[model samples]
Target: MKRSTSNQEVKKLNRNRVFRYVNSREETSMPEISAALSISGPTVLKIVNELKEEKLIREVGEFESTGGRKAKAIAAVRDVKYAIGLDITKNHVGIVYTDLSGKALKHERVRKPFKYTQTYLHEVAAIVRRFVEESRIPKKRILGMGISVPAIIDVQRDYITNSHALGIYDVPCEELTACMPYPCELLNDANAAAITESNRSRTCSNLVYLFLSNTVGGAIIFGNETGIVRTAQEKDRGSVYMYKGNNWRSGEFGHMVIHPEGKRCYCGKIGCLDAYCSALRLADQTDGDLERFFREMEAGNQDLKKIWNEYLKDLAIAVDNLRMCFDCEIVLGGYVGSSMEPYIQEFRNLVAEKDIFENSGDYVYVCQYQQEASALGAAIFQIEKFIDTI
Candidate 1:
């Protein structure tokens, strides 16, 4: 019985390995998979046949023959499985449908103020159902759904511990999941963006992602996975961290006190990073129009440019502090980060002025996905789970 169990486990591992290899490559032959994974040709052929029978993979074409007979190539059926992602923020709700490869097949956005009321929950459910129905993909094909929010999540309890942006706390997961048909998961908005970025590229393994939207948030990536960095004191922390003692708020970087006697934040704090770095702060400079603010700055509006320069100065201080603590690449993301692409060089220069060691722009990078990252990342979380189960 022991030997039988071991054999079964080995077979399952090899099957998953072959499936992953084929999914990663554009197209591959049985011989190629065998060589890459160091599995025997016969075993590779058997797994390939099994995957084909399961409709997970299909023969795409035949590889060119160097000599003798040509080899048949196989590729993963990307649409065989799907997942849904939803991002809920203070001002908008974004929805996305993604395949196994994390490609967004369909997406929709609606403007609505977030509320923890039952009416809001029902509205969210309606939007998700509408998106699924319009996608034209069979419901069963969608493995699960992931919900992203700008708040601290207690994964063990499946609850939102606290979210200053939404002004809600201790909300049960069922409040949102009960309205949906598929299985649902709750994730931090910044963490979701990091997951999406990690799935998009494997180039940088260790890094920090700063989410600068209406509320400032962040995540740390170590060895190609999201992780938490421990700090001795709350004052000496970044945007995200594990709570120590009775403290429920740990990684809230936006709430970190930057100016001991600066502007007041919505969290009833003065001189916080959020007060200086959030997109809402920028919009306030131009009568609540961020676009107009940037437009004026671009047109040589000295007053607006001066306001931007001050904002950059404060931002540089916060970014430099984080860089010194983490000693890894920093990724700027969210609505504000996407817009900063045009002025990335300028921002880098400001950061360089504050850094004593590394003055190069190589340490900082703009995110690949702009506004869609959080929603797409949420969907990707579900897709990853589905893949693991398979």
Candidate 2:
């Protein structure tokens, strides 16, 4: 029985590997998939035929050959399945949809102020239904939907333990999303954004994603692990997992105290990183326009310049602390991150000044997906579940 179960697992893994390889590329041949995945030709052919029958892959055309008959190019049927992600924030609701390719096909942000009431939840459901209809994707094609919110999630019980952003507490997940017409799940906004960044690259397995939006948050991703549970580090590249802590409140970087008696935070705490380093620190100075703040600062506004300087100093402290704890790449994400290209070098210098291990700040970088990242990541999370089954 043990051997039978192990064999089943191995075969499943091989099929998953082949599909993943085909899905990741624009076009690939059977020979290339077999060689790259180190699978026998016969087994690769069997899996390819199985996937083809499932309508998950199709032959695009024939590849130009170096020899005999040209190899047939197989491509993933990306539209075979779809998923939706909803990002519920204090003032806006972001909606995004993705296919099996795990890329956001369409996204929209609506200006709907959040209220902790049953009416608000109903409205959220209404919007989701309208979004799906407008997207023209059949509801049956969507595998699942993920809702991203700025809150501490209890994955075991499936509820929001605390959320300062919406001023809610002990809210059941069903209470927040029960009105939606599809399968629903909850994801921490920062963690969802980190998932978006993770999908952007296959090489980076470990990273500390710092979300620098209105309310700062973070997510830690570990790569080269055997599975979801922590185990002996695998030498070969393997699955990546998020460290959600024992209580599922792992990446609360915003609350980390950077000073003892500094500014007060909305969470009724003094010297919190969010108090000084959040995107609001700069955006508030420009009537809540983050882009205008950067524009004016670069346009030689001395007042904004001084504020920007202080913001970077506080940010450097938090980033350095994260580096010390995780010792991995630090990805700056969120609203402010979109406009960070002009000032990344300057910010890196500040972080480098505090580094004791590395001389250069090469590990720090801006995120790839800037807009609606949390929403997109939430959608991709659902896509991952379907891929795993394959």
Candidate 3:
């Protein structure tokens, strides 16, 4: 059965939609918001006044005349609140900060290996405090912080279920955030990175992001995040919702078996995609330095070239499988993906050979944001949630 909303609910929804429109654009007019959102002119006027009183938006100058008195130009006060994002990997921590514009204002990476202990958690919290202090952003202006971890995060339960790379399972969410100064939330690193990828376009899109890091990871993005509330089944909040499965373990693309009875995977499975396509497989050849591996390959190192050729063959299999299942854009992201531009065409040719529905591999793409994407995406989650409240 479908549920109906109250009059107050409808009004709030309309107000939120109106504010989102203003925030999304550089500047918009009252008449433009009315027509664009299908709200009455008086209703837009009232909402504009309400937002102005709340100081979430400001009326700046006016638009050119259209055979009538000029309309006030309204824009969102993007700096009213800010958010910080933390990306937790096996051996490094990536941090990024963003405002309403949803772009990373600044980011930094620190080398910090994972350690399961209360003391480590406290140190991580201190790291955030130091970063914020260095940035000189007022504490009051910060809304909250989002932590992107390499694990299956139960957003509703607020706990981490499993993280192969981190060597932990079923950890309480508080262990990592209990010592933080500001409110913090957890997100799967790949899912968080996908949000950053989608935000790159500044438009809603349905796509799948294939994260090629130490351990392979993936995430799915539904088309509409800020769209009107049409269904009661919406799970993850704000502009980008993840398709977490029944066990909250969707997009586990790494476990897919590409070559049965072949090489063993770290998860004790044979021939899982992770065993074949993880960036580590190639980086391991160059003493764990992925950049050096690429540089050596570009300089025509025959041994590295042989390894890359085999790696791309395996990557093509995974890329083709993702395309077949999602039928949307497949983005290669993470450590190795940052360096894939030089060989994407060659890899695409391999994917095209396996694809039955399409002969072109144009759908396969390299990710936009690199190491900072997960952290930035995690911060955007808080930013979008703040926008929803307005």
Candidate 4:
């Protein structure tokens, strides 16, 4: 037989349950929590009072009266604590501070490239620390730090398997996060991107996220509650799945050999989709001048327009393939996806023309959060985990 729980254990469990119940609802009353947990009215009152005293919850308003006394409404004070999410990229590092709701209060980006030195880690850590200190939140209330990086991460092992852009090999991400006051967690950028997309588009039941930036990444969303993205699940936390299969590399869709002997890729491959469809490729098409290309596109330059059309065709094809494979919403993200907003309809129309699906025009579209997605996604990941523990 299972050992009987002590009063203290029961109280702790009930307290956590009450807190979670309140936080999950849009608005709730003390009596509602009491009824749901089958606890005494006085006991629920005591639990809620403690949470309010801790500044973790607050009275939002009053509920409609039922021909008697009106009930006071309560909701989670997400700002009582904050989470820091860092998106470390090769060319830049995006740092953001957000509440439990994934609302970014303040954010700043450092343009410096990744340096494999103590200086780099220190610089990133110091910026994050300063942001936290300025938020005026107590250290104890702060949730753990979440980091998103475009690398092969083994979160269980607390180390990065490989980061091509940063030239990192088996670096312990936890070690760097430990320098901060709160606990640290590492996540893959693609997985984080998928989380952002899922949160931004509530209507999508399942998703296949494609983040095509300087490097390519992907995420798979199974439903609202589950982030089926390979790197986000706890069981695969410390495991690294190297891309060993032919015709199927993890998010290295950018490096696919579209042409037998085309432009060389950074990975020493030829005719890479990245070589043909990336922002860098677009810039190269304009003779290494991004400003000129953008300006020309804006000015309705026929040549640039033609090039963009061809590039977007390749992107649409990629999306079509992902949709066929996952049978879910296809969300495009990253800096390039942000700029493609005005052309979303055109892209959709082109996909309709492809007619891959029997319905023809029933293809999914791009993400809503756009550029800030990965950072916000990293923050949401922490928030969801924290709620689960509660």
Candidate 5:
């Protein structure tokens, strides 16, 4: 009887593994799951049945069979587990409501006035509460909340380390979100964007993603994955800096001193990458006439073309440097990447001209989602955390 119990325990563990693997993706049949996991039919069915009873997996539809009965499709009850992704920028707060599958059901934004205080946090939290209430998703289905902030975050401290633009320093994230109905998590904006980008681009294992909006930042994927976790008050040290090279620190990319004599950055430095690669910089180049510059570029104006070409070259150089250091795919994102459809090839060509690597041809790609990339990625990260805990 003791030997029989050991076998039963082993069988139970195998079934749980199969259930997890299948529930990780979109709906699939038992045979497809068995083939994917290399498990026997009986074991898969036994495990799936147990999962179904637990209300973790459910029947979706039916699939055609080779020469037997129709196979039933199964999928994770993703709608039953929702997540919220908030992009807390210097000038605005962008919030998105999504289910476990990272589907954005709703989105909203609040403007940032030049003069504001920590009260802004409260205002942002209110916006989140309103969105969640409007979403009408059961609170029990919500896994948790993931917040993307445009600042260096001390994840262990649960506080913003430095955000000069917002005049915030070492403010506890949990304290700000104390009224939140669920658990809360914080990620650097750029890393959050990169996490979202990496999830959608499963084709590459290693990649660098740039977030170049009101501020500039980067996210690195060593093995095409983001390991977002939540621990105790000491999680602030949870950064990739100690893992990557010296130059690969998270928000420090924006301060790379591209132009020693150029305009001053929010961090009180001059001619940094953020000073050159941001939408604000582009707007500044056009004297706050963004529409005019975009029109001129679309109209093929020679002067604007020269400026754009220079911008692309600078961007290409940064990407090339990152590519050499990381030896992975490079992605362009942020407000610039959203409008990159017309110039992605232009940037690629420039990078190809100067890349030191032999496989430069396959190392660069554009981000799939432009506007909501970070929000979706936050949702994905939260769901993965939820799954791991379960």
Candidate 6:
């Protein structure tokens, strides 16, 4: 027997559709929304009125009249609700407060090592409390909080399965959530970054995001306007080129055998991509400062230039392999990727040389964000949840 949809459920769906449509546009009139969504004019009016009453939307101004009456234009209340995102990495805690539209209102970063202790959790909670209070956003208006970590997370159990970067394993989620005053969720940092990028590129349905931070991670998003979401498994977050019936370990994008018995990786693997392409590799060339490394390279430092050239070569190989597999826009994100914007053409040239096909440049893009994407993405998760319930 087929399950029938209830009138209330249908109304809710229509409401969400109208809300999403309004949120996507700069401002829209009732007739425009109704025409765009194929909804009745009276239904659009009723929904818009309810949204205004709930403060989720507001009349901004009026649109030019086609002939007689000017239509009132409405927009989503960007700050109607707030969400907090925390990026807890091995070396720093990044915080971002986002509004309903997923715009970051404020951002803060603290250079504190991550520890799985109650003291650390309390410290993080305290910072969050101070941030919210300082912003003057009501607690009730804050939908929830989201934490992004560079590790495999068990969402159902709220457990950190493993975090080699932080050297932590099996940490209970309660350690952090227990201290938080608002509802909280744990998300993989790379996945969070992907979510943020997806929100920014609403028109792009298929995207492959590579997060090359302290550790390499990635997320593959596939779908259309009806819905688009990341579908990569926890274990396959960043691993590339997994053949059928193969038992390849994850995070091997960093550990891909780029060299034969070359530099040793922290993963106890020789010739890993991380040894050649990670930000740490560039830092190592310039005494742990990537800025200095790039500056010296630009200033005609022969040694640094050689190292960078070699790094780009390895990166090109990985990128080319990914392109061949997914054949979609590959977004390079994270601290290193954002900094590479100035040299995008150079990187594109390198990729073109390595790619078997022409026009590889068309498929590569630098992320819009650099440091705060993970945190922002985490906060966006809360907004997504709120929208789903509505």
lDDT of each: 0.80, 0.89, 0.87, 0.71, 0.70, 0.79
Candidates arranged by TM-score, highest first: 2, 3, 6, 1, 5, 4
Clashes of each: 4, 0, 0, 1, 7, 0
TM accuracy, model 1: 0.87
TM-score of each: 0.87, 0.95, 0.93, 0.77, 0.84, 0.88
lDDT of 3 by residue, 48-77 (tens): 999999999998898889887988899998
lDDT of 5 by residue, 1-390 (tens): 353336765565466556556665788888887897677899788888887887788998898777889999899876767888887666677778776565567777778642344476666667777888887878788788887767677665566777665667677776556765568887777787787776565443556787777677787665523333444211221222223334324535777776788778777778778777777767666776555777778888888778777777777767777777777667778877777777777677788888765734456777777776776667667876765443
Candidate 6: regions farther than 4 A off: 1-8, 225-252
Question: Compared with the true structure, what per-residue lDDT tens digits does model 4 show for residues 143-209?
Answer: 8778888776765566787777678877888655666556777777877777776755544366666
Candidate 1 residue 317 C-alpha distance from true site, Å: 2.1
What is the clash tally of candidate 3?
A: 0
Residue pairs with colliding backbones in model 3 are none
| Highest TM-score model number | 2
Best by lDDT: 2
Which wins on lDDT, candidate 4 or candidate 6? 6
| Model 1 whole-model lDDT (C-alpha atoms) | 0.80
